[model samples]
Target: MEIMNNDAVRNVVNDVSDQLRRALFQAREVNAANYIHVVLDPNHPVAPFDSLHPDHLEQRVPSVKFHRSMRADFQHQPELCPLVVTLYSPGDRGYRDEELLLETVDNAVSRCASVNGSYVCGWIATTLNGEEFARHIAVSSILSHPLSGRKVLPWFEPHRLALIVDRYPSFAWSRLTNISSWWFVDMLQQLRVVSPPEVGRNNIIDARSTLLPLSGRQVSAVWDDQRRIREAKLVAMAMRKAGLSLPEFPEVTLDKVVRQAYENGLYGQQDVVFFAMNCLTLSEDWFLHPVVQAALEALAGTDELTLTDILAGHSDAVLHEIASYESAGSAPK
Candidate 1:
């Protein structure tokens, strides 16, 4: 099926908009949620039902309905409906239902894309007659991710920094903790950045293509300052928790480590993993920043350490180590 032109799409949207509104309105009245899938081709070779996981169509709520409709029948069988709207209860399932809906829709669209022709796809999320959380209807083909199977609509991926700020809660908290060790890692785990099998084929995960600024030396002062400040704050918090009396050094300190990191070319995403693995294992080289070292030391010999640990360890020893090192005018060797 070829992609519908602007006028053709507008006509299709007008035809289905009322049906969608009615379904949404009914769903709201019962305090349930619904998935409104509007696909352009009624007889597209791919079937929506086949595209989704079996569980999605199974009865998991008070009611699950699949409605299909179109203008006219092409052959003997009723012309496949261009609109397949699945109305189901979101009652008490948290984000699971939402995830399933999107995943199923995404799968369907993906299969359809493999076929010839153009098609438009869209979905909406709304509370029972109460409020609409999101209403997105875009050309589905244009909005696709690099990764094949783990697909999500836009605003769902933290692939880009701005997307991370907008969609990642941990990012906001990281600002307060000043720990950027996980920012790049989280992006990878979340599929914001796709990794081809070629890198892992050699037992090496190279992200040079996805993450920018090949090295810390390439980082701007502003970015460096922001990263350093957070790292320092996190280290200070760890020291304080380890029973060490230390002043908040958000505005100062950790410069030596940060500068060293820049000189050592430790600004890439892989550099983050390198530092984290070393810190976890307490490696001999100590490529991590002093703040990171202090943070790790604060949690030495623990199965699971939390921010609270920063206040429970041997304070005097921790304080003496930090202070003596500073007083000696030496950086960690």
Candidate 2:
């Protein structure tokens, strides 16, 4: 509940790793507070799947891995693999770079908001916006259990992702900007829930084996998935119920949200808002306008006025505050 301080975020990630070990031991639970697993294909032309994480860490907990391609499309991508999540939680001694790391996260979030060219921006925003993540954060794998036969990896830091943007331009950014926000959110949401969608039923193919074999385009297909469509509908409903203006783009979509980050660069895009907003609406994860969220957070427990009232008006300072935060790990706080 405290502001997502570095220590707390680190603790949560640590807990997730631990939960992963415990779950694998008794096959009981795989919460986010513990550990997460990343499955790699033995035949894939990426990092070695056998020795990704250090041995000392594994000795600390019981972990499992199901070696095979997932039916999903991200199976073979190495960059998305574990990519070294902070091994120890903030509670542990390993969180030495808590401040710096948090700054990194801050930068990532801000950049995502500043740049509309990526779906991750909305996803990160939604993750920071708890209640939406509370129950699901504990899931061991991004979409399922670590050993769920699907390859799993750590989420990428924004700056880290941005650095590589120039490298895989046609590949990564194209996926982020060109795709629908709902699609990423839907897939992200689905990954946390139960088993992935069935690639083929009756004929009985293991989701574990085929999930990753999916081509980049196939994985990206989640952008137009039925689940994604459903998420879009829900977002539209929330906005309508809130009496907020809905985007005129495709009915109830994430293009609006991604566009907000893209065009206006709510985090600081200079003026890409109008263009991006033209393409999308809301992401599956509803990161209400930061101002809206701030008003609600600042009000804390007054219970007197509604959120609509709080965010209805703001001075220029609010804009500056937002700018500072978007640039660094939150204004000089």
Q: Judged by TM-score, which candidate is best?
A: 2
Q: Which lDDT tens digits does candidate 2 get at residues 1-333?
A: 112467754565455334333433321122223222222212112223323323322443333222222223344553332222232221233333333333322322222222122212122111112221221222222333323344432222222223223233332322222111111112111111111222243212232231223345543432223223333334444444454554433222344353343333232222123223322333322224477456546656564654335544767686445333332232342
List the candidate 2 regions with Cα displacement exceeding 4 Å: 1-6, 26-37, 40-194, 197-256, 259-268, 272-333
Which candidate's lDDT is highest?
1
Per-candidate TM vs. native?
A: 0.22, 0.25
lDDT of 1 by residue, 146-192 (tens): 33322222221112232234333332222212111111112001111
Clashes of each: 12, 40
For each candidate, the alpha-carbon lDDT, in order, equals 0.33, 0.30
Question: What TM-score does candidate 2 reach?
Answer: 0.25
lDDT of candidate model 1 versus the reference: 0.33
Q: Which 10 consecutive residues of model 2 have the lowest summed lDDT? A: 182-191
